[model samples]
Target: MGLECIRGASLAPLNTFGIDECAEQLCLVHSDAELREALALADQRGWPVQLLGGGSNLVLAGPVSGLTVVMRSRGRRVVRRNGDSALIEAEAGENWHRLVVWSLDLGLHGLENLSLIPGTVGAAPVQNIGAYGVELCDLFDSLQALDRRTGALCWLNREDCRFAYRDSLFKQQPGRYVILRVRLRLHTRPVPRLDYAPLAAAWQALGLKQPDSRVISRLVCDIRRSKLPDPARLGNAGSFFKNPLVSAEQAAAMLARWPGMPHYPQVDGSVKLAAGWLIEQAGWKGHSRERVGVHREQALVLVNLGGARGGDIMALARDIQQDIERRFGLQLEMEPQLLGN
Candidate 1:
């Protein structure tokens, strides 16, 4: 099928932030061929191409001046099953939460801890999306991507993606490849991960002797629903900032002063400080000037109350960043991808 392009498309409905903006051109591609055709059309027209998945983790600054290709392809099935382990492949545009539920419905485990994460399957690896105690890298088998520059297809393994905490090679080298599909290895035997304090506490609170993936997934969904504001109700891109990593010595020094600061020591000799706690301590929680504000429940979430412009959100984020840096002497990095100028 030929690629269909829409000019002057409103971008507010495309992004989770609901920021008012427009795209010069927008194309929804349901297959790799359509994606390639759209890219080629952009090249022929001397316009840049921007790739968009679910738009859950994006901040549209203003009107985009190029062809924005929104991936809409969808498919998922078990590619291989060997004894207790099965390999499942899903197209880039498949909803992440739906995939998690589908895996559980098929008696496959390993994705329960990552339930309720927003975005498409393709965007998961880009951020190495993680929650509770499990990350996307844990079950990742391989992924098929189309190299935009060379027009070649490449299969990248976990190591090739260079998976890190909420980051990957796909993000390090932006606009290099368009992820087409992802393969994950799941097991029939339940392997529940409740090591995270919140999950463990919730499990203990439930007074259950043992829980399956479905139970754990339900608990996680409940926990997330309680803590996070629904984007449909109040516009938000989940966590707005990445947790700041600091040296052990720095963490110790800070802890000595605060005594109650939440921190996790990594195997790499670094400490991950909670950004939400820092933001809360800096007095930004439930703070707002006009339409942009920090969520009252989750200090990490910056919300668009109503009629908020991208600049207002950015300004509030900058103010929060400056306050946190000045108070804690640590820098917080934004998690969402900011598009346009």
Candidate 2:
């Protein structure tokens, strides 16, 4: 199907949070042309359009009142190769984890560290998704997107994207452009980044002298699986809050108080503190109120027990944010975007 539209579509299945909500209208587009058609249709009807990918990073706080377009375009290929480096492209709707595996199969490096991230390739650049010690921007080459304002497809380079720790131009200006495809620069050589303590320790335990991208990917997946709850079994987003960044002075003050709090110093003279550690230290780990609560194993994650509403989840998150501010005097920013209300 080129463009499929449904009225009063249930959004519970679209979002990983499993929030029970409905979209006034939902359109599934399988190609860039279809996507454009859907947008034109929405405009003709005077309805606001909302774009959704894997729905792994959104919260529906209320019923969606406009046209919700789901990106389902599909394609992937090796664009060109030169010596040890190669350029690869993937359609917006391809699964992120599958793309990582495909790159490894082709003996390409750089994407192995982001293995098992739950979302589409299109959504990856929006959040500049990262794991272990690698972010998408590290490997990103360029992307083709449709400028909604001008209706022209254009390419954006790395500098044009303006990626920063879990933030990007797409996120900064939501709904301005529709990403059609993404290109990443990869390598034929195995270049592993095992700076994260847990992953590095696991690698040492393996006792392997050779750097293997596939093995690194497996280890990252194992670590994530152990720490995060499966969205299939439990209704939840991967992480509820972004790790809070504070000034060097602020970090020094907190370290003096807690002494053992986990913090990573950045080159910009800022410190990235673990959001999970803060929640756990504040005694909210494994805490539940009604149908929403913090994950028992990972405090940064807020899970849906069952039959939970969007408002309930936000209320729980609000409580956690207020408590963290009261206890630590730092604000906790939510990672997922709110889709409604």
Candidate 3:
């Protein structure tokens, strides 16, 4: 397909935040050739390019200047299978939750714990997206990405992507590589990960000793729906802040002061502190200012009640960050990518 560009495109419909913003130019690419063509055109025009997937994890500041490329490619297939294990590949544009469901439908099990995560498959690896006790890196096999500078396709292994807690190499150097497709490995044999306390409790409450992948997926979906407001009904980018990782000493200090603070020790000896607890402790839960507010149910989520501007949301987030820092002496980093700078 040839590159098609729309001038002065409204970005509100494209992003999950529903903030009204205009992109100077917008192009939707469905294939590698089309994506390369769009990049070439942007380069020729000296326009900076921004890659957008399912805008589930973004905070648009205002009007976006230059070219905005939306990945719309689609495909999913089991590329290789062996006895109990199989390799699956999905195009960048496929919905993440849909892929999880598709895997379960085919009797695959690894992705059951990651159910209900919003955004496209392409954006998954970029964020190293995780939920429950599973992360994309756990199932990731490899991925194909297009180098914007050289217009070459490169196959990156799991290590090449440099996956970290809610971060990746793609995220480190933004606008350099456009993810085209992702390959993941799944198992036919049931490999339920019911380690997370909430999931384990839900499973136990169901009175089932051995639940299948479908059951686990359904439980995760239900749990997410109960806590998070649907982006369609209420504009939100899910969790707004990354759980801050503190050193052992720092964690000990906070633990001494609060004693009820939820924390998880990492292999590297750092402790991961729950950002939601901090926000709630700082007294921002269910807090609203005009159209933007912190979600009443989930403190991690910032929502647009009705016609909220990006500035309002950003300002509110900054205030929360400042308050949390002041109260706990810990800095919180935002999870969403901020655009239009």
lDDT of 1 by residue, 1-341 (tens): 56789999998888888888999999999998898889889989999988898888988888889999998999999998999899999999999999999999999999999999988999999999999979999999999999887999999999999999999998899999999999999988898898898888988888877668999999999999999998899999999999999999999999999999999999999999999999999888999878999999999999999988888989999999999889999889999998876
The residue ranges of model 3 lying beyond 4 angstroms of the native Cα positions read none
Over all chains combined, what TM-score does candidate 1 have? 0.98
Tens digits of lDDT, candidate 3, 97-124: 9999999999888999899898899999
Per-residue lDDT tens digits for candidate 2, residues 129-177, read: 9999999999999999999889899999999999999999998999998
Record all residue pairs in model 1 with backbone atoms less than 3 Å apart, i.e. clashing: none
Q: Model 1 misses residue 41 by how many Å? A: 0.4
Q: Each candidate's lDDT (Cα)?
A: 0.92, 0.93, 0.93
Off by over 4 Å in 1: none
* Global lDDT of model 3: 0.93
